[model samples]
Target: MLPEGNEMYRSTYEAKKAFKAMGSGYTKIHACVNNCILYRKEYTDMVACATCGKSRWKVVEQKNKIYNNIPAKCLWYLPIITRFKRLFQSKTTAKDLTWHATERMVDVGVLSHPADSPAWAAINDKYPDFASELRNLRLGISANGVDVNRGNRSHSVWPVLTVIYNLPPWLCMKRKFIMLSLLISGTPGNDIDVLLAPLIDDLQLLFDFGVETYNAYAQEHFKLHVVVLWTINDYPALGTLSGCPYSGFQGCAVCGEDTHCINSLNRISRVMMVIEDFYHMITRSEDKRSKEIIVDELDKLQEELCVTLCLLDKHFPPSVFDVMIHLTVHLTREVKLCGPIFFRWMYPFERYMKVIKGNVRNKNRPEECIAEKNVAEETIEFFSQFLKRVDNVDIPPNNHNNCGIHKGVDSSSITDGTPISAAKLVEVSAELFSKAHFFVLQNTSEVLPYIKRHMEFLEHIHPTKQNAHLEQEHSRERELGACRETITETMRWISHGPNKNIIKYDVYAINGYTFRTKAREGKVYQNSGVSVVATDTHISKEVVTYAKNTYYGVLQEIWVLDYHFKRIPIFMCDWVDNRKGVKRDKFGYTLVELKRLGHKGDPFILASQAQQVFYVTDPLDQKMSIVFKTPPKNYKDTYEDVDEEFSTIVPHNDNILPRVDTLDLQKENDYFRNDCHEGKGQNLSTSLCGE
Candidate 1:
């Protein structure tokens, strides 16, 4: 405040004036209070609305007052062309705007982004001119009602947002990149089309003649064309935007005239296919089939869905056939028409709505509050682009942007350093040290040949012993004494095992996951839970059984064992008892009893082997919790590193749906109640029915 040569404005009026000079202001167009028409175009000079005959200005008492001019309602519209031009004007975003065309990996059966989907290819094939310019934009529109009053009163402010598919998959849906096109106050209902007219007109203009925009990266100007690829919304908003009936007999938009439903008082019928199988086919990001195969599968799924719906009609009442149930028939078609559901869904927009709602400081004028805050943030973010050594304050920096692990080298691994003073060192017992050392050696690629030679020597000596017994023998220190001299220097040190004194940490980071011990977990989000899937072998006298089993545990300590040459991190966890303490619910969620801990003797696992997970307490029982797995923040499911032989960590695929062909639904034998005994009326009713 004391500095005189600063560029900062002194007052809100001065700041607004400077921001306005930058051409980032919202244009306010008055609307009829009755939601009849907007006071624009031919109605610009009118004093009253043409359709409703209502005064455009708000009525006020004039008793020697200033009589400030005010509109009853107004729509804050941010012009689309200027925002698109600003994207290309920035060197950073200008290069990123063409990432889909230049940097995206093109694979036959993998789909990680919207551009990898069939819909993008179809657009390229049909509109060759639009595809000719890699900088041309493909957009997705999303709208939702943001509760402005925070449930204190009945008020909603709807913001129509547009997402650019030109940016990379990681940045396209981020809050800073999403453009807020229009903000309408109150309930628009069916009149949303009227409010969307201005934005639609601009889109049409952009598509017809295109806009001349400067590309900062190319150092030239090009005509930029735009197209709306799809819309993201929930079921109710879907009906509002598409003008489709979301209920009753004509609930489905894709099925059209052939919608299926049942009348009231229905009994039951056999379901044709499993609903879980249908869910598995649509949400898959990896292991996708070819276009021809997908079309054929969609055709089969459509037929199966029709029969399933008819069977559902027989079993359940008409109320059960809501819009969501009916929308399943259209899902396969939507995947064919518009990529995967994850790319074009309302989840990201719903999350962004929280940020939008947080800007409402003034409850009385929420629209104005949001508009001013948005423009301020936008101006700051744009200014950050031209400055050096400055981060865009509006966007949070990714803390989990980890690089890939190179073969046999651990330097590329990232971790938040331990405390300088509290770098506690603890000495574990002989059994604990051996288990941790053996796990690190078993998982490391450099120790594979030495392990193979040791296993072969064990097989030659113990011919009658089972492989499981030999494996257990391999983990012991006495068995490794015979071959310690023949192994390499790294393997020799690993075979001898780490010293009893090792450095211990309360927190450690690996595989893009931040882990904390149970005693150290005091934050809002829990990070103590962990899981790993490994092969379990059972050996009998005549046969052997091998099955992949998942183990869940709570992290108790983080131990980094120093092998002189390299430091290997391992976690000491209290593993939950799999047989009695763990079970899967009907909805496929893993529930574990945290109190029922087991496997105390064998508690250490390599840090690289852990797939980070968190436990949400089950509402039904406080002792139980539902497990939710987490993925890395910047992890993209692409084939960009397909040729790499070994990676420190692999993406978890435990949730991938299994390939299933058919499932049969069983029907009950008796439909009527034969035995009923409650009070005197129940027996009388049973006698009268004579079942």
Candidate 2:
């Protein structure tokens, strides 16, 4: 019965002869087939199997044949051998085909490898068409399969024959049918009826046939067929229903329906419109009050609508998934819009109001607080439901949290209950309006008027309040004064006059207890000149002394002698013994005491070196005298030269006399005139000071 001219048939005979010649003890053979070459080794000696009358051979010569040279009669065997190899290799190598085959095989066992069941054999006998068209069968071979080199064989006849005989006709037929079904069902179209009609009919037929077959073979499995049919039909119904309104409806007036249902429909439509409007309001508008109303309405609608839809799901057996999907998408859009709208319309003002209100009202109203807490909890529950619906639809993770809207609300409440306040909320709302109004302020200067208006509004509400909390405000005012003084002093030094001409320096000296004068036209009299007095409160000497003592090195080192000379005494005053108990003889003329007396008598002396000399009226004599020598022709003597000459004739030995080498009083006067014409603390003074 062996095929004629077959190389394997010839090789089998050759192997037997070789074994017999070598005498009987051979037990096994190793064979390798590669690229039309068959390499074989046979055991030449004989052995007996205890369980049966079979004989084994061992230790014969190795044999090889290049399949290309083998007789043409051997070709018939190649396909059979190749088919068996493909079946073995497909298990590891081809996933798509294997998955398709394996899934089907779970219901119907492997077609190529039959089991011991008579039912399977009878089915095989009835369908004798085992071989598939070569084009339809995809072959795969892998190193993981039996006989790794088998794939190298050009024409494996035995495997091809075995596959042709063993292949199941039912599997191939079922595969073809499924592929055809998928092709017909997957066409694209907006009209669901047209797209799905053919698929539904085919699915129905398949359902009936499958049900019949399962009932005959295994009655219990017929229900699974019905379930599969229902699942496939679900998607089609969804598409059809979604497109119905588009195809069947006309204008509302023409589609005459019952007034009650029609009214309900109109209300639902209005809810949708309001939802959409809220989206635009939060995202696009800048009006705070309008946005607030929209947000509140949106919250109410979300709660009512979502609960309504969930209840509808219980009544209708159709896919609620699509409706939930639409609702969730809308909710997600709202959540995303909440943050920017809140920040623009509500957050800042709310935060400011909360700060202004201080928590005093809430402290005594625990019941009201608890009620508000319940509202917040309800809000969180609404958000949770929205999130759950979104999750069921398998929305991408990136869109899940709507960029942290829920987290933002929760954090704002938990960390600081409603961080937004009324004033800041108004400010932010106004900013948003401004942004919407000009968007690109072409003139740019127009922005100034808007800012001025807003600032004026803030002033009206939080106005300076007469500095009623003056002590608390003092440190801020002091810092501001120091900064103004620095700028004025800088301008004075850069100009040609004494710093007294700088209005800020004069004001500072007057406030610091280092300057004094009778008022004329609300200005301090000094050197035949009028200087503006500082409006800032006088800093206490005791506090100043404490500051100097506490931060001695820091304060002393940075106290600019040319600008802030008043700050220097806070450090030096420790050496001044004005106490009556101290012996006047031991301290000599008491320069420290004299210095303190000078500060007390003429605070204007702190303004400039010239002012100090011009206004040092002795308290005892009631007369003013210059201690240093008179100015040179140009008043350009070096500091050391003037100091040496001035030291030769001391006026009062232990008196705190002015140094002769100090800046020329006339030049300093000229500097102040050039620097302080606008006066200090006025808005125009900033221009004079350059900053």
- In model 1, where is the ten-residue run with the lowest total lDDT? 643-652
lDDT by residue (tens digit), candidate 1, 319-342: 555556656766766776666666
Per-candidate clashes come to 1, 58
- Show the lowest summed lDDT stretch of 10 residues, model 2: 550-559
Residue 159, model 1: lDDT of 95
Which model scores highest in lDDT? 1
Candidate 2 stretches greater than 4 Å from native? 1-198, 211-224, 228-243, 247-303, 306-691
Backbone clash pairs for candidate 1 read 268-315
TM-score of each: 0.75, 0.14
lDDT of each: 0.72, 0.25
